[model samples]
Target: MPIAFSANLGFLFTEYALPDAVRAASRAGFKAVELHWPYATPAADLRAALNETGLPVLGLNTVRGDLDKGEFGLAALPGRETAARAAIDEAIAYARAIGAQNVHVMAGRAEGETAERTFADNLAYACTAADAHGIGILIEPLNARDVPGYFLTDIAHAARIIDRVGAPNLRIMADCYHMQIVGGDLLTRLTHHLPKIGHIQFAAVPDRTEPDHGEIDFSWLLKALADAGYDRPFGAEYKPCGRTEDGLGWLKAF
Candidate 1:
């Protein structure tokens, strides 16, 4: 069976507005689409695009607090509950507006027991809020190189957090690009953590480019996912080297 692919609009289509990007993904044969921080776009316009194109939003990320100050996220920071919860609330509300299925609650840079507690508490709140709207929460383990000092950097760590929160709707967003950089042995890690994985995303290893030219053998990687029974669409999250459409040979190559 052909793989079901979802374009990560945040990285894939830089040339168009979010709504137009959704339309482009649909025209390019993507089964679904995901997003980064799309708060700037009017939810109505994005929703209208979704309705017109008939594409489901797989997931979206909460805002990265104070980007100018290098704040990647706010969830795991101590003494920032108000800001953190507000971000979560905003993301859930936005996700609802655009009919997104999941919200990736980003855990910014931090450490120690206090940070862990903060993250868990915030996640619990997010999970409860999202559950009411039939949405799930996803936590991803980002690599240290790109997001140094990030609280969530290990899959097992993320799983432990999920277990701690014990929210039925909370799960992990397994990004192969970050995982490959932080931890090799993709198949084993993915299979080991398959039960708790809510979504799987991919790009080339070494460079966050289209998967077709990466050091990672995406053909084998995707096959491994299919063999493991991951029926959900695999998210194509990567930076296009040129115009987004020109870099889409990977879509056809798959």
Candidate 2:
């Protein structure tokens, strides 16, 4: 089977507004799209755009408060259970409204046993809420260099969290850009953790640009994913150096 791709609207189609980005993605040949935060545009409007373009939303992220103030995520912060649960609930509602398949629950900056316990508990709650809607809850390990002090930095740690939560709907959102920066063994780690992964995203490592410029060889990696029976959309979650459409030469064949 051919590997599918989803445009990450949060990074791509910046020249256009969120609602128009969905149409832009379809024009650019993507069958699906994902968003970092689509709350600014009402779900009804986004649904209209999706219906117009026939592009399904693959996944979206839970609210990460105050990007300018450097709040990356909230789920793992101790003493913030109320805020975390609220964020999860909001994500679930938005995802359900838009018919998204997965929601990535961000873990925020946190540490120690207390933080871990809080994160696990919050994930369990998120899973329970999302399961009813048939939406998968994903946890991703951000590379420390990019998002210093992110709670979940190791994929193995993330896997353990999923196991501890015991939520059948909980899975990992493995981004190759972050994983390559954290460690170089992309294929090995991906293969070993395949069973726990719900979604996969990619970009050029070091620069976070189009996949073609990277040393990771996404052409081979994507084929590997298909050969390994990964029947899910590969998310193009990167900043385009120029116009997003100009940088899509790498994906022309797909």
Candidate 3:
């Protein structure tokens, strides 16, 4: 099967218009597109764009509660329980509205006084709401280099949490960039954790640019995914080195 690909619209920006970005993605043969945060564009406008272009939104990153003030994740902190719950609810509502199937849950810092039990309780609650809306929560682990002190920085740790949560609707959003930065044998890891992964994103390891430009052999990696029977979309969540179309020419042959 030809793997379905989705463009992350946020990176396609060039001080140009949003519709132009959508057009570029469609012209490049992307059947689906995802926005990092749809907050700037009215939900009605986003819906209309999808209608006009006939593209489904693969997923959207959840709202962040002012990271400048040091807020990170809702699922792992006690003080932000109320805010975290609200963010999850907001994400679920938006996903249902935009016909998106998944929401990326930002894993915040694990520091300070909050008990591990408290964080687990909140995550369960958030997962329950997501399950009701027919949306899956994608918990992503950031590499320690990019995000220090963040909980769920390791894939193995994330898997352990998913096992603890044990909800069908909650799963890992594996990013090739972070995994490679963390220095792992990705093919072997993917084979071991296939069942827990709900989504996948790709980019060159250190630069976070398009796939073919990186050290990772994307053709082989994508083939590995196909061999593993991964049915979901492989999210193109990378910064375009130049024009989005030029960056994506490699996919034509894939």
**Regions of candidate 2 where Cα sits further than 4 Å from its true position:** 66-69
Candidate 3 local lDDT, 180-251, one digit each (tens) = 888669888876888999888888777988787767888789788878878877778888788776767767
Ten-residue stretch with the least lDDT total in model 2: 63-72
Give per-residue CA lDDT, model 1, range 1-254, as digits (tens).
88999999999887999999999999999999999999999999999999999999999998889888888999999998899999999999999999999999999989999999999999999999999999999999999999999999999999999999999999999999999999889999999999999999999988898898767999889988898888899999998889988888878788
> How does candidate 1 score on lDDT?
0.93
How large an RMSD does model 1 have? 0.8
What stretches of model 3 exceed 4 Å from their correct place?
13-20, 112-115
Question: Candidate 2 lDDT (Cα, whole model)?
Answer: 0.91
TM-score of 1: 0.98
lDDT of candidate 3 vs native? 0.77
Best candidate per TM-score, number? Answer: 1
Each prediction's TM-score versus the true structure: 0.98, 0.97, 0.92
Q: Number of clashes in every candidate structure? A: 0, 0, 1
